[model samples]
Each structure stands twice: as structure tokens, then as C-alpha cells.
Target: MNWPTAAGSDSRPDPDSEYWDERQETRPPGERRDEIIEKIGEQVRYAYDNSEFYREFYSDVDVDPRNITSFEEFEQLPILSSDDIKQEQKEHPPFGRFLCIDEEDIARIYGTSGTTGRPKVFGIGQDDWDRIGEWHAQILWSVGLRPDDRVIITSPFIQYLGSWGALAGVDHLGCTTFPFGAGMEGQTEQAVEWIADLQPDALYGTPSYALYLGETAEERGHDPAEDFDFKVMFFSGEPGASVPSTRRQIETMFDCEVVDQGSMAEMTPWMSNSGCRHLENGMHVWNDIVYTELLDPDTEESLEYGAEGVPTYTHLERTSQPMIRYWSGDITTWERHDETDCECGRTYPTLPKGIYGRADDMLVIRGKNIFPSQIEDQLHALDDYGDEFRIVVEREGALDSLQLVVEVADDAETGPDEFHDLVRQEIKSEVGVTPDVTVVKQGELDRTQFKADRVKDKRELAIDV
Candidate 1:
């Protein structure tokens, strides 16, 4: 199939045309904030006027949406929690009081996986769907996927909205999308064979799936780095892509650039803050579309640059089920674009390290705090270990035990006995808690084609018993 490409000397797009919307992306910081504030006023007023949820939400807080004009006023508004959405959805059935558009105007429906509980739902208007595609296209373009790129979306077309958004952006960009969905029997094998046969230019899926695909390709006797023609791989649905060692591993396996992009399901346009082609650990926040804030999780006040805080998102353009001050539990440190001097020339706020993990995911063990990413970074940094791993936290008598079950790669030079202490010492130095590191043979640990739930906390089960 033929694909469209812009006029450039090389196969890639011209460097001058790097940004999808140069004027909007590179707008002065002062001007961008002013624009965001203006949009905030409009969205708030629209939500209050249209949706009963916003009307009552604002009413209960004794704050008038009409009174909110500046960014400061917007910050003063009440924050929306995931629990709040779940409760409202349960009480209201399908779309809650947050449904702004008329039922007849609804164009599409999507929701969370609900693996934990009843899924939170969202109703999308046609205009909003179009905008979602446009915003995603901007992010994809920023990460070096040109119109000529042949993209393969490995995520399934399921209740989750991650893959659909990528499909929309790829379609919008006029890229040839091979929607080779995952999770079916023999799907990973097929994905590997197809990549070898067709040679797609890019791939989109969770970081774990990308890694698994590399392993699958290897098991099938195909060297992923040499066999595939992928120039870039973008991931969502997990923090592995943002982890330095994991990113390095994927890049090495696929011989491609890895870009990390995603957020909570409530924010359907999850690519609000995505990686730019230029910077490592750089994800620029498209604040104009979705007004994003890094607020102190406890105080709900805006955080300064370089401070770790919860990512709070307020939809500036979403009309149907607009999320205002939605507190996503994910934690990360951010800096201003000017501070990073990103080569992309976009003045959007950048999450320099991408997302660290959810605030709730942190484990307090033996009076020491630890995150799964900390262990993951240390584990993948070693040459002997494979990408698959499991973090099991349990309460043993009076103390907490952190157990790491990891897979040893097939081509490792040394045995697990020789390298086990090296793994234990590296993790101890980083997270301050020494874990019981158990090394298993390759392919011993379970693998998932979607988000990998690496951490299994047996403490809750112990408490229940």
C-alpha cells in the first residue's frame, strides 16, 4: 500500500516541520498559561451549565463556575477522585451526572478495565473524538512518527481506550495501521512473523508487550534487532518504558527509539504529556488541550518545578464527561520546558522522569519506603536478567519481606549463583531495603501481552486470613 510523506531529503520528515502545531507548541510560556486559563474558564462554565454533576459539585463547594476566570481560581476548585467517579457511576448507572451532551449526540463509549471493580465509563461526542485523534497525532508526530510510517498497534480493541486513541492518531496521520491485536492465542507469534514479513516502521503497545514481543521473536529463532525494521516504539499502559534500564533494554532488543506516553483511563487523551524525539526522559505536557497541574497530593496545591507531586488533570476541550481537577494517583517530578531547554522547542511542561509509580504502589517495608520501579531499574540494569519479573511483598511475623522473583536471560555468561549477590546489592543500594532475590530460568515467569502487574502484595491476604 502507498503512504504519503512530506517533501524531505531523507525518509524522515523535515526537521523544520518537527511539531504538529508549531505555533501552539512553541508559544511563549506566559502566553501559553494565559491561553490555558482562558480555556479553563470556558470549560468550567460549559460543564456547570450542561452537566448536573458539575452544577452540584460546584454548588456543594459553594463556588460559582462563573466566578472562576484565572488559573488561581481554577486551582481553588474542588478535586475529583477516581473513587468519586466510581461511586457516581454506580449510583447513576452508565453515564453519571457528568454526561454533558444529550444521549442522542453520543458518538462512542469507552471505559476502564474494571479489573479492580465496576468500570468507570465515559461518553464521547463526535467532535471530542476528532479532537482526541488530533491531539494524539500531535504527540505521535512529536515522537518522530511521520505520515509515511507504517504503524502496528499491538493493543486489543477492548474496553480500555489506549489502543483506540493510537489507532485514531495513526489514521489521522495517514499512516498505514496494522491493527494486529494482542491477547489471542498465537497472537504474539503472529506479530513477530508479520513484523519479519511486512517490516512495519513503528509499534504501539504497553512497554511489557514490546519486551515480550522481542522475547517471542527470539524464541522463534528471529533476532528482533536485526529482523525487524521498526524505527520507533511508543508505549502506554505501564511505567516500564520510562524506567531507564527497561527503556534501554527495549531499545537494545528492537534497535529502535523508545517513547513513553500515557496516563489514567479517565483522561482518554492519555498522551497529554508525551515524549519528544529530542530528550531522554522528556514528556512535554500539552497544557492547552488538557490543563495539567502537578499538585501536592495532600494539600491539593500546585507544586513547583522539580517537586514530586500527583498529576492532576482538568480537561480543557472535553465537553462530554469533562474531568475537572481529576486527581490521578500517579507520582512524578516535573520541570518547566524552559528549565529543560528541550530541543523540540515546545514550551509545554515536561515530566523529566516520566511517571514514577502510583502513590499507593509504594511499599513501606521494615521502616523503609520502596517503589517497584526502583527494583525494576536495578534488576534490568544487569546483563544476566530477563525482562520478566515479579515483586511479592508479604508480612512475616513482625517484619515485612520483599521478595523478587526474576528470570535469567537465555544467553547469560554466568550462572544465577554467581550473579545473585550483585542483584541483591544493587537493589539494596537503590531502595534501602534488601530483597530476597530469587533467580529463575528464562520463560519460567508468566508473561502478559497487556499491562504487567508485577507487584503481588500477599500482606492483604494475610490480614484477611
Candidate 2:
């Protein structure tokens, strides 16, 4: 099918097309907060009246959703986490009452990756699916995806949200989509060969998988940039896409703009860090469908714009499986920039910096706190280390310990012992912890085709020992 193309170019839509444009343009800074609070109240009342889960959960709170209008009262409601959703599903079985509609009404079923526990089953009605597709289309446009572009997606389609949502975006954009599902078995090589032939204009996957493809392309003597006219490389499922070192590595290898896309299966497509221009700032949230708030992680108290805190999101569009005051577990600082204009002239509130890291991912070792991303940033700084790595967590005595396992680059001749010492010193300097560093041969550790599972909890091993 011939895709729809704009009259002049393949760039993103005019800023007016952004969901937040009208609200941001018309409403003054002071008024926008009140409007958002009112919208939240309306959404709460609608969900409580219509959704079984919210109705039951809020029954004990004993307050009219309308009266509980301001952000102050909104914070009074108990925070809902992934664990809460999982427990509810466990008690309800199959599709949870979190769903507003009956099973017959569900058009699609998608689940979380279940890396932590049982995958949370989320149902999407036809309208919800369409909304998701539209949001993804906006994200694609934000990152320079055009109707004439051909895209290859490397995320898994196995009941996961990333691949399906991204595919929907390509379809919505009227671009040709090649679903090269994850897994580095024989299929990955074949997918690379196909991309070499088709020469898709864009590619999407986690940073690790994208790097793997680049390495594979090099082995086959095929330069992806030269062979395929790729303009954008979209990445998600990990923070590597936003990290400077990682982004530079991918762009240098693939010869394209590496754009970071962020969302959860529960939230679907909420925001994309890729602006109309290539500045890798914070993600532009879809204010029409989702409302976001930052709260002090410890106290759960809401923080004003530009303050760094944990991110909590409320779905404004979700009706099938409504999530209100859902704690995303990601920590970030947000600001509504009304005066500062981006190069693209989009007036939507910008994140300036994408998600920092999950509050849960923080590890306290030797009285020092550290995040896996910090370790990742430090490791990526090393000249001879491969992009693939993992941070294993274990309990030693009464304290938690961290170990760094990284793959050496192909050209690096440094021995594992020397490399380990270098990594150990780097961690001590950066994170203030002397983590055990182990350098493995190139491709020694299993390379993930989807989200890279870096942390392996070895508390059981510590107990056994």
C-alpha cells in the first residue's frame, strides 16, 4: 500500500497536532494546574462509576470523587503499584475487575514481561487499541518517521506491549513494518539479511539488540547505514537509549538518530523522548490521554514542576482497565516550559531529561546507595568494553553487594584480570563502592534480543553459602 506523505516533507506534524498544544497554548501557567486537577477529578468520578475495580477500591475512602478534586486530596488516595494490580488479578483470576468491560469486549490482550513476577494481564478494547495506535503514530512522527519510511521492529510479539504498540504506530503512520521478533538464534541473522535487502528507513529495539544487529551486520560485511537508508533508530525497554555513551555508540555504529521511547504495557504509549528536533531531552507526554505527576518517593507528596521525584501517572483514556494514581516506580524531574521554546517550536511540556531510574533499582551497599544505570554509564565510558553488560546483586553477611559482568569489545586485547581491576576502580570512583568486576570474553554472556536482564539476585546463594 502506498503510504500517505505530507506535501513538503516527512518530518513530524506541526506542533498544533500535539495533544498538549491547545491546553499549553491557551491556558496560562497558573491556570493549567487547576484545569489538570479538574480533569483528574472528572476521570476519577467516571472510573469509579463505570469501573468495578475503582468502585470497590474507593468505597472505603468514603469521599465523593468530585469533592476530592484538588491535587492535595488526589494524593490522599492510596498509591497503586504493580504488586497491587498483580494481587487483584490473583484474587479475581483471568481478566481482573480492573477491567471496565466484559471479556467479550476486549479486542486485544497484552501482558507485562513478567521479569519480576507473574505478568500482569491487561485488556485493551477496540477504542483503546485505536488510541494506542494513534499515540504511537504521534511518537513516530516526533522522531522523524514518515509514511514513505519502511521500519523493522526487533521486539518480541509474545504477549508483550512494546512490539505490538510499535507495530501499530508503523501501521498508523502508513509505513511498511517488518516484524523481526527477538531472539539471536538463526532468525536474527536472517532478519539482518532481510533488512539488508529491504533497506527499511528506520529500526526499533532495545539498545543491546540494536548493537547486536550492528555487530552482526559488520560480520556479514554489510554496513547498515550504507546498505540501508536508515534515518532513525528508535530504542526502548531500557535506559541505554537515553544514556549519552550508549546513544553515541548506537548512532556511530548504525549511522542514524537514536531516539528513546518510554512506556509500560500497563500505560501503553504515553511519551517519546524524541522531539521534532533531535535533542534527546525528556519525553513529551500525551496530555490528552495521560496525566503525570512527580512525588517525593519517600513521602508520596506531590512536588511542583521541575522538582526531581518519583513519577506517578493517571490514565485519562483507559476505560477497559483503569489505573488511577498508578505509581510508575520511575524517578524523574518534570517541568512545564511555557517560555523556553524548543528548536522545533513545540509548546508541549518537555521532560528535559527522560526517566532517571526506578526507585526499586537502587541498591544500598557498604552504606552507599547506587543504581545500575550509574554502573552502566561508567562501564560504557571504558574504551574497550562492549555495550552488553549486567550488574549482579548478592547478599554478603548482612550487606548487599554488587558485581559487574561485562563483555570485552572485539578488538580489545586486555586480559580479564587487568580489565576487572580497571572496572573495579571505576566503580569505586563513580559509585563509591568497590564492586566485584568480571570481564568475560566477547559474547560470553547471553545477549538478550528484548529488554536486557542485567541484575541477577543471588541472595539465595549467599544464604546457602
Candidate 3:
């Protein structure tokens, strides 16, 4: 569906309005489907005419872009992966052929670290930038941010839009954007003092970073819930705010509600789904600007609404550069509302659980499908494990084994045997794999400034599967 255009810079929505996009957001699913089909045809025709890369790609695949009329037909369009874009950038050099806007029209450029290989850079034109701001503005609003609120962002701004994209939305929404970049020495300590001093209305960062900073503050005589004033805490980049125990712990420590925002790097970096602001835990998908589907990772077949699968998003209004069926790699599920399902009263598709985990991060050991997020949730359910953990997988006598080494936070006074049984039971219940649980002392796992990697596979590979 076509995203409603942003109002002029001088024009903004009413601060007290129930919704940012009142028209499109509350429409019934059947009503929007017709409009979505019309917009899909228009976007496809525009991309075929303006993008050199799409012209050749569609032709190579014997697909006529103009022939696509419905979302079902549009989904037949070829899917693109991160590696595919990297290769195109390598062959084209700098900005790839998919960039539809002229070089002079480019307003800003952001990119990924490209740890796998070549970096992927995306250009943002003036119009695209404005629309992106609108997308994120609505995201913040859905997560309980207000126009009069001030937010302190803790992600780096250089060569990254994860933080900058959100800050831009804050500007458009008339909020004071606090620049507090993390991933540096003592940044957490500095954030602690700033939160206590300024007492901002809202705080933003990854779940781990925010919780770590808040805990470090408590360790140094400052209680976040008492000293700091935070009405809401918005988080992205990782899973935790959505986990019940972790969410409860953070909300109690900060004395505020925790909201989860979902986004991907290749996408505009924000506004994939926004949390409900009116005391709701579901995440609402921005189906107006983007079309998405959930598919089984291995079979690449679309799944039912409630089944867990990989997400693939196609940008509808992205004019500077168009992304067609980009595999998001994040595992999630969604269900359309049956009228008043959300307390927010918006009809946007809701993700009851924000994110399960990454599809690529799944561990298939001994024919059992396990996800680290599931295990993390188990750890969160109990207090024996600390904030840090690691999963060690190894092969023994032609059989795979899992060893869950969890850090002892020292707060729980349970014995080792009881702790092991508790963790084993939790994992067996959640991940469906009964494994050996080892309770290690605190500080056994090194903590990073960003999302912590917890999985370690030490199994020797065989010549054949």
C-alpha cells in the first residue's frame, strides 16, 4: 500500500492524536488489499523504468515488471540477499546500479560493516529521507514517545543509520535528541551519569546495552528507577525487551515500560514494526510502506500466519533505491487483527511476539531444532543464570551434544545440582533438547559493548552429512 505522504516541515500531527497515520493504519485488511494491489503495480512499473539493475534482472529472469499487478504476482519477483547486493556493489563499484536517483540528488549514505565481505552502501534522496523520517516518527510514537519528550540515543552515528535514522525521526517529531554513542570505553559510565543528571523522558539502545548501563549505574550508588525519570524505554537490535522476565527486570529497574522496535540493516534501518503505545505488547507492522511474508527458512515456502519463519520484505515507496523481496533473516510471526485485538485500536498487522531469533542462528543438534533466543528466554525465566551465557556444541561418538554454560550471577543461592536441574528442565521444555547444564562462576564470558554472541560450535565436521 502507498504510505501516506509526510506533511510539510512546518506541518505536524496533533501531539495528542491517537495515531500518526489515522487513515491507513486503521483500515480493514480487505479494504487495504485493493489499494495495495494498485500501488504494487505502480511501484513495479516505476522501478522497471528508473532502475537499470532491475530492468536487466527482470529480463534475465523472463519477468515483465509491468505484468505484476497483485501482491501474489509481485511476490513472484526474484528475492535478493545481502550477498547478492555485495556482489553487485563490487562489480559496479561504490553505489550499485540499483540506485535510481542521480548522484546529485543523493542526500545521505549509510552502510553496514560488511564483516562477511564487501560493504553494502545505500543512498537516501531528499524525498526518501523525508519519508524515512515519517516511518521512524510513527515507530517512536507507537512505542509511547511523545512530542514533548526528550530521548537519549546510545548507538554510534558514523557510517550507521541505526541511531541516526531514529534521531532524525525524533527531530521530525519535535523531541530533543540526546547524542550518547556507545561502543567506546566508559561510555556506559558516562550514560549512567547523564541519565541521572538530565532525567530524560525516554531512553533508547539495544536491550543489553541499556540494561548493562542501568545496572552499572546501580552498582555506583545511582538507582535508575529512583534517581532517573523515564516514562518509556525503547529498544532495538536485539531480543530482551520482548522476553517476559528480561522485560520485567528492566522495567522494574528503570521504573518504566520497555518497548521493542524491529528493523533490519538493508532496510531503511527503522520502522519495520512499531510497538503498541497504549499498554500493549504486540508490534504493528508498517504494511503501508513495506510488504512482507514469512517463509520456512529451509524450504523457502510461505507459512501460516502463526507459524515461525524467515521474513522477506519488499519496499514499496523507496524511490532512491528499491529493494525487492529482501530476506530479513529474522524469525518472526504475525496475525491480522480481528477488530480491537490491540488496545491501541490500530488495525496494523501485529506481531504478538516481537522476534523469535535469527533463522541462520538456529542450532540443529541431533535432529532437534533449537534457537539461542529460546535458550536465553529460559535463562531469563530463572534467576540462577547471570546476564552472560554460552552454548557449547560438540560431537561425541557420532552423536551431537549441547552444553549450556551459564554464568552464576551470585544473587541466586541455589546449589549446583539444583541449578543444573532447573536449567536442564527449562531448556528441555523450551528448546526441546535435554542437555547438560553447567553453572560457571561470574565473569566467565566476556561482555561486549554491543549484542553478545553466545553460541560456540566445537564439533568436528564429517566428510558426509
lDDT preference between candidates 2 and 3, better one: 3
- lDDT to native, each model: 0.85, 0.73, 0.77
Model 3: residue 390 alpha-carbon error in angstroms:
1.3
Per-residue lDDT of model 1, residues 203-222, tens digit only? 99998899889988988999
Off by over 4 Å in 3: 1-8, 60-63, 339-341, 460-465
- Point out the higher-scoring one by lDDT: 1 or 3: 1
Better of 1 and 2 by TM-score: 1
Among residues 3 or more apart in sequence or in different chains, the pairs in candidate 2 whose N, CA or C atoms overlap within 3 Å are: none
lDDT score of model 2?
0.73
> Where does candidate 3 clash, by residue pair?
none
Q: List where candidate 2 sits over 4 angstroms from the true fold.
A: 1-35, 66-68, 272-276, 336-342, 396-400, 413-418
Give TM-scores for every candidate, taking all chains together and pairing residue i with residue i.
Answer: 0.95, 0.88, 0.93
Find the number of clashing residue pairs for candidate 1. Answer: 0
In candidate 1, position 267 carries an lDDT of 84
Q: On a 0 to 1 TM-score scale, where does candidate 3 land against the true structure?
A: 0.93
The list of candidate 1 runs beyond 4 A from truth reads: 1-16
